[model samples]
Target: MAGVAGRLARRWSWSAFRSPVQVTCSQAFPLHVSGTAMMATQADFENAMSQVKLLKKDPGNEVKLKLYALYKQATEGPCNVPKPGVFDFVNKAKWDAWSGLGNVSKETARQNYVDLVSSLRSSESTSQVKPGAESQQGTYETLVVTSDDGITKIVLNRPAKKNAITTKMYHEIILALQAASKDDSALTVLTGNGDYYCSGNDLTNFTDIPPGGVEQKAKDSAVLLRDFVNCFIDFPKPLIAVVNGPAVGISVTLLGLFDIVYATDKATFHTPFTHLGQSPEGCSSYTFPKIMGSAKAAEMLIFGKKITAGEACAQGLVTQVFPDSTFQKEVWTRLKAFSKLPPNALKISKEIIRKNEKEKLHATNAEECQVLQSRWLSDECMNAVMGFLSKKAKL
Candidate 1:
């Protein structure tokens, strides 16, 4: 455990460094009004509303409040209704957000709303386009999403980084899952573009510290991680993982959430959360034990053990292993047949199977993320991350 004084000192030192672009309670209103000539039109407001409907992940309570306030102000001039009583926290908060907008004109409110949505969308497009990526017309930077013949395949596209997941990739995957959930496809598949299935969370995601400090970054990341995992827990369609090669960290841990996970004979599974001075996530703490038994789960999650394809199959983490020579051909052949099954039947059957554990899985996800949020700010995690980076630099 870290000394209390040291922790206190670090928090105090970091607290004053405010994120320049962040909007807080005191700075909420008067949101960066720009040229009135270019103010968003009524059509823009409607477009923004439609875009909000398509958002996959919840943008959090604060942002929701802002959106609600902007919409009410833009459409209805100002808040005229009586504010709810003090004990009615939910309504009271909404009233405060709207009433706080004061006498802002409808045009200005619309513009601000448009700007907010644009900013939100901008954040998700931060991933750099890597070389050799065969990006489709309407695909995510870190993933290639395609639906055909009843299967929606989401392939991790950054093979140059061994398919390591970045922050943007996490958000993109959530978006892809959301799209697949509503598509005509009977099932959704997750795989990788190149040799490795997924190397795990891109370590560089930890190195960039915004002015919000480690605490704020940890909190934001925890929220993203929670929503990312929740996508799998709630996915209605059959979710299959085509583990073409190795998988690690979150990629390996999340396999438990899939209905089926097929791997190449050369593929390996690993979770090195402990090595990074972090705790288990992706609901591995709960599902790992349930799927593979306590001792084996402890070995992989608690002790950071790496297991081979055959071993993972034996432990029940993977459904089956195929030869590298024909892994894709074999997996696709089986998946195509599975996908051809009645979509509604497959969906309902999955719901029935997952119903008993849905609540538990959600609870586990919340608890694990909460623990990780704390761990991400600790000195131990920071030091371990730095050590990992230093070695990578040498390489």
Candidate 2:
């Protein structure tokens, strides 16, 4: 509730509520110049405004302030309103942002807004692509894998489904990891689109019984699962997990494989394997205990405990936790800087650190998948999954 209030407060001001001033762009910014060029620019500016609403991710506060300043300047001509008081931080920051524009003409501000929007859209497009520099496979349906600015980023793209990992997603992810390993990027980052980092395996994968029945389905799935996890274990470069929001099941279990995990205060980590009558995967059985110790790890993997970002950090799962409002800006800044380091140096260093555990992780992964194959064929696992899906359909 406090977080909700805080976010609302940041978005609005007491002064705005007390004395509202509304100005439409067309009314305030009357054209000084005549002709098709001015009319075209105006249309483009309005189009840019619409495009801003379509952006997939927040462009951060600094960019938002610039946009606010430009929008106000273009429409209202200048910041004629009285400066907000110091104590009214939200209003004050807004006032400062607008007032800092310093009497720029409305036409220039409109053009600038259009240009800024264009730049932002372009950057976003580049950030979401397949990893290999020369590869033709630059697009994906369930994932975005790009190598740029010294970092290879793998973004889970199923936002409407809370970034759930479908069978197709598992294959794409494995391919992305393989590409990232050979890419020139200094590091690799794993994250997600929209609210969730990942909600874990799509339960629908269980319902679709194949030609060979449940036993064959389990065996085939185990192979894919082993290959998927081995990609993480064998990754040569530094692997980072940016936990933007709540993560569950395999998503939370896999964090222990990452070299660094940065999370927002709003993010949560949970391994609810037991809830579905399943045991742990993603080498969490080995890595979780090593990071969080046996008892705490058991609380999560066995008993289905969910921990907040702070608790995850305290237990050595997450490297750091930042305020939810500042998380993306702060984490991306550090990641970009980290990516500037020598690529080979970072890769070799990560390889050296992972060398001792590589064999053990592979062994653990094999054992876990072998167990999961058997479990998947069990009536307990089948009943639990079916019940969950039944409840979901009702919801």
Candidate 3:
């Protein structure tokens, strides 16, 4: 709480202090304009777009409309498309903006737009928009908290090691979630870096946990692990996951709790609990059987099967699977649109969906924690883990 307030206050306060370039592209009768080929080329259009992106502030909606009209006129020659309906103010404005340019040559429209950007650029000084105008304010050392346009993205940052979640990272992620829940943000996106979403708990930290009897189990950080997973169960805002790559261990299981799951075609989700002599941790013990049926959940937990992105989607674990190349951009654009909805409505809707299961989810988490802690010190668990680590070392 208090932490969330302080961090977000500093994070969002600077968004207003910016200098945005002004754009002018209004016409009452677009189709009536004179058609002439100006000297402006494709290079000019590219430069203007780049400059517009570099402005300290986001371009206004009107400017965006002009940019679209100019782009269409420049590339396609003219608006052959029919005007939108009178009720559709948005498309109507856009139609008049372009078709009204009626006979104007594509190059002429391009030249005027390019000249507009140049003039705006000349008026604003470099000092007005300094490099790194956005401070690394809410940014964490092991977690990336990127918040803009009412959505926050928490990217797991340990990409070099498949974005493995370390103890420190778990704590940082917990804090990030807490902050996002209390903040005005309408949605939060969770994903990992590099070629994997998250490899789950970093095994390096498990080296010291003695492998054997019930007496030695208490020393392991299983309780902390349980608490960390609980964070996902209680998240307030809409939580979405982008499974960018391989998701191992608890990472795959947590997908059951996300409001939406978007995965890349290259992604593989594996819950190798049986292979590791462990049990489900993230309430998958309850969620999986319900979401994917008892038979499928048994196959995943007992057999440790590797579920492909497509398989996960078919099993109802993933909301959608996108091509690896376009995964981020496609998911991000949709999330931004989702973020613009009525915030309270979204929250209440989510609450209603999870309403019945919320308490049982917590109870199951506690039950699963007890079983996992006991399993941690069992003889079978030790042999399995050591063998897995040994093979990993050989690789």
The C-alpha lDDT values of all candidates are 0.79, 0.77, 0.71
Worst 10 residues of 1 by lDDT: 17-26
What are the per-residue Cα lDDT tens digits for candidate 3 across 124-218?
54225443322233457787787789987888888999988777787677667756775678998898878889987776655744556345544
- The TM-scores, one per candidate, come to 0.68, 0.66, 0.64
Error of 2 at 118 (Å): 45
Candidate topping TM-score: 1
Among the numbered candidates, top lDDT falls to: 1
lDDT of 1 by residue, 106-208 (tens): 8877777776776566444532244212224265788888878899999999999999999999988987776677678998999998999999999999987
Instruction: List the pairs of residues colliding in candidate 1.
Output: none
Deviation (Å) of 55 in candidate 2:
45
Give candidate 2 misplaced runs (Cα > 4 Å): 1-138
Superior by TM-score: candidate 1 or candidate 2: 1
**Per-candidate clash tally:** 0, 1, 7
Whole-model alpha-carbon lDDT for candidate 1: 0.79
Per-residue C-alpha lDDT of model 2 across residues 1-395, encoded as one tens digit per residue: 56644764567543332211211122111111111122227787788877776667655555666677778887788888998886666566567777866675777667656656655675467557643332333556788777779888899999999999999898778767766776788989999999999999999999888676878888889878876886787677899999999999999988888999999999998888888989999999999999989999999999999999999999999999999999999999999999999888987788778766664676677678888888999999999999999999999
